[model samples]
Target: MRLITCSNSAPAYPAPTDTVLRTGAAGGLVPHLLALLRDGGDWLFPVRGRDEPRWPDRIGPVRLRPVPVDETDRRAHYETISVELLLWLFHYLHDTVAEPAFDARLGRAWAAYRRVNAAVADRVPAAADPDALVLVNDYHLMLVPGMLSGRPRVVYAHQVPWCEPDYFGLLPAAVRREILGSLLACHSVVFHSTRWADAFVRCCERYLPGVTRTGETIEHPGGRTRVVAVPLPVDAAAVRALTTADRTGAWRTELDRMADGRRALVRVDRLDLWKNHLRGFAAYDELLRRRPGLADDVWLLAVVARPRHRTPRHLAYESACRAAVARLNETWRRPKGPDPVTLLDATDPADTRHRAIAALSTADVVLINPTYDGFNLVAKEAALASETSRILLSRTAGAHDYLAPLVTSLDPCDVDATATAMQAALDRPVALPDPPSARRLRTAIGADTSADWLAAVLGTPRTGTAGRDVHPTN
Candidate 1:
């Protein structure tokens, strides 16, 4: 079977027959994905910055095809239009009160966004067979589905769909129509959760006049598109194995020393604004303030991945988070007690993974708090990889829809409530279950595998009974 997938970043698992098309950036999972693809036979077409070195034509059996896009202009457009504008729009971050400042410059950026997507579209069909199963990923390539038109295309929305008509109507009428029209061109449109899927359909019905929803399918004058909620899957077995591996013995020992018999509250996230690092620090401070007794012993191990795109907002947030951590340490740290917050960089893969495994294995409480997210995979990773049973997860996170019953759910904005929950978790007789029980919980919570997720996306009949119900968004 011929398979073609387009994403801003390459897939973690690229089949030998797969043709993967993506854009190149400084940092992301792309580097890791490239490392894996170096030995595979998959065809990789990367739309790279003009200044970046061209990838070798071949690496073992894998083939590299480069598309050079002007870094200065394209990146300016991408940052402003795609990342700044569209990202905020889709994530529902626009300040309706103060309002968005839409001007001619932004309009130009939108035009460039179209041009870049057109460049990607040109390479997509060129890299695939006429009947290839074409899959487009995330908001970055929203226009590609329409560009591919009649192809057997599937588009996945990795962000929360801005369903509120008023929120969507903020964009120019033509731009709004273009997005919905383009998405409707696909055979199927998938989302990480049923809530997002439902939101997308509602947005279409509100903005596109001819659009009609029947069951999970959205029909328009152009075509019929199936709206499906296929929750992203995790490799639970791999995580479990990583936890048991003895390779990170030194790191685990260091983590144990740092904990010093105190309860470890660990969080692994990028220092992104939406990750809500500042708010998380506030919650931790509140936790210490409310329960003064625990402050002397409890340690918060926050391994933050450096911000990939150092936008002004991200830089400011990162600085503020650091300040908060320092303040907490200065105010609450005991001479021999664990630091209130210990920060680590995820820039180094080996170090990051080792630290992650160490924290997961040794922590008393794992905190997965994000103000809003497509799906917080760390929550699942902690569930599967950690010996810890107590996870304080944010209700706003997409993972909460599925893993809520298993974790102590907390509102990310509610500092007092989150502190109370943390205190209660610490007071529990068993902060974590036995290793065997942890494995059992992992199996029960991780209802789907990546293989199952791919099968569902490609419309192939499932040969295994490992996935959760793919219910209609309605």
Candidate 2:
């Protein structure tokens, strides 16, 4: 079949060894998308830059044709829509209120949304083969299915969390309808978790005007869409290989030396608002305050990946995180004692996987307390890497649906509760080589690869109750 894939990001060649000026963070999806591209397809992406070895032309290898969308621009408003608004919607899932500046931000977000949709509409219809199967990934290209000519078969995959009717209704009436209508324009819509897919159905029923739900099909004024949940899995074998203790590098050596005599509690995340690093540090500090005997016995290795474009808000958040770490080290490291926590920078722009190996391999306990996440791969990665490492999980993370029983759950906002959990983790310690449900977890998370997920996207039918929270079994 002739396949045409659309993504907001393009692959950057000549990476690492010879770095070029990049205006943005290489998004989490870039690597995954490249992996898919390697299997063969024509990928439509915005131009990365002009100075590369081949700028106006292709970048990747043969069998993969890179079609650059020359119409796109590097504007900040797009981020406002893709990151900020969706975050607020997820944040206000139960509540009806939003931030004071939400309305103003929404205005800018819509402008960028229309601009992107318009660009895709103008380019895709002309370039796509009549028999092409268009695969749109994530919210960045949600409107592409509807905008394109009705000839190609389009599949929309929503990789993030979706809100229920009550919260999703926060969008203005026209905007809400537009989004729903656009999604329904596709043959099928897929989500990373059942919770998110069910939420999408609920939103369509309550918010999409004249919407009718018959089984898994949601029929709106424009068209109908089949909703599906196909959780994406990390390359388990690949992650395990990267995190083994035997991996050698300068960074790995330095990191191992740091944890030579102490248990390392590790966290890996981009310095974002929802990652909740500040509160994480506060919990660590509280743990130290309560148990003076445990002082200097643990090392908190916070592996932070810094973005290229540091906005004012991000700058402030990063500064506060650093300040908290500094204050804790100063308070605990008395009389020339070692710092209790070391903020490890994992932003080499070249070899982050190797750098991450340094911390993940040494981890005695892994902390991932994001306030909200669609699904966190780190939990699964840590489990595969160090089966004995205790994982402190956040209640709001989508992985909580299946992982709550296996790991210690915490409300990221509750510093005291998190501190208590931290203590509990240290008290029992890891006796077994793996977690209690190691076999089950391994089976659940490592069952499917991106290829299987893509196949599921192309042909999986709805299997269970919509909006029903069912845990994945081994």
Candidate 3:
């Protein structure tokens, strides 16, 4: 089975040893696919928008070269112009249907979308093999499936296609129809959760006009669209192995020394608005405000955010978070002692791992409050590794649906409610689960590793989960 996975960025980049770029999305998926290919499967990895210093003639002995889309600026202009214009028109039209509060800067979004599409079109071919099964990923490559004459294509939506009413309400009906028609014409559609899947179908009908639902609707489409909610999985065993390393005892000791036998409230997130990091901090701040003595007893450790793109909004948000942390530290000071909340730089991977494991080991509470998330893999990872009490979870996160029982659920939008949950997490007396129970949870999660998800999606025999087992390389 020659399985191919393509994306906007490569799994790894060849940067100078000293000057390293922070690993982001591309860092997340490419490694899993490469690992699987090395183990047993035959795989083809092709990423667009890459400039290698030494252009490889082949990847793992497979002939490799960029596939050109058009002669005129590599079709980038046409592709970008088409998609960005469509996005704005669709967002304007769908705003009333999805939600009135959905606010995305459409003009800014359009500009970014145009740049992304241009890059994608520069890489994808003008025409592709209709017989080769194509698994297109994200909105950046939305036009790829449409370009193929009669291919068995599968689209995996990472975000709500027509999300945020204020944003998606701009697109005209005709453009939306063509986009949905192009996507629905595919053999299958995959979403991270049922909520987004349902929203996607609604967008199709509201904008596509004549589109109708057929068969048992996972989501209602104007035509025969097969939608499935296949949640993404993490590499649980590797996570545990990394966290449970015996050689990292010195780092653990230093972290433990900092803890001073107090309850540790930890959150690991990029400084993004959608992550609700400020709200999470406010919750911890509230916990300290109400129980003055507990402020001295508990420490909130946040991983500092990396410098993202040179966007004004991104810079502004990062500054706001830094200010908030500083204010909290000033407001709740330890009498003649160190700061209550410690903010570590995001680039410190070794420390991040050590602190994450130590937090899981010593946590009285692990808080993950996202404004909206397809699913928070960290929640599951923390839960599996946790030797303490229930996690403080945000209801908007997809993992909330699955791990509700093990979490102290609250609205991510409400700071007060989150504050209350944080207090509850600190005050409530619940005994830690025995080793056997913790082991069982870890086992269940390990069964659904990234390898399992890939195998099932590719129609290969998966490890378990019925006969959906794919062949795993040794």
Off by over 4 Å in 1: 10-46, 49-53, 58-62, 96-99, 126-128, 157-163, 245-247, 431-441, 444-447, 461-474
For each candidate in the order shown, give its overall lDDT on alpha carbons: 0.68, 0.68, 0.56
Count of steric clashes across candidates, in order: 0, 0, 27
- How many angstroms is residue 50 displaced in model 1 relative to the true structure, after the best TM-score fit? 3.9
For residue 173, give model 1's deviation from the true position in Å: 1.6
Q: lDDT by residue for model 2 over 89-204, one digit each (tens)?
A: 66452234434245665576676676666665555535536666777877766777778647547888776678778777777787778787888888888876667777899888
The candidate 3 region of ten consecutive residues with least summed lDDT is 465-474
How many Å off is the CA of 425 in candidate 2? 2.0
Instruction: Tell me the deviation in Å of residue 357 in model 1.
Output: 2.3
Local accuracy of candidate 3 as per-residue lDDT tens digits, 1-474: 333434443434433442222233412344445554443322222333334324344444332333332233323333333333432232232234653221354434444444444454344333344344445565555654454435454444453223543344445444455456667766667655555565677776666655666532434343355665556666666666756787335556766777777667887666655677788888888777778888788888775455333245457877888888899989988778667887766455435555555555556678898877666677776776665655888776766655555677778878888888888777777674545644554565667766666555554636644122111110
Report residue 415 deviation for candidate 3 (angstroms): 1.5
TM-score quality measure for candidate 1: 0.87
Error (Å) of candidate 2 at residue 2 is 3.7
Q: What is the TM-score of each candidate against the true structure?
A: 0.87, 0.85, 0.77
Question: Stretches of candidate 3 above 4 Å error?
Answer: 14-27, 35-53, 58-132, 157-167, 172-175, 214-223, 246-250, 348-358, 430-441, 455-474
lDDT string, candidate 1, 355-418, tens digits: 6766777777888878777767777777776644488888767677666545788888888888
Please give me the total number of clashing residue pairs in predicted model 2.
Answer: 0
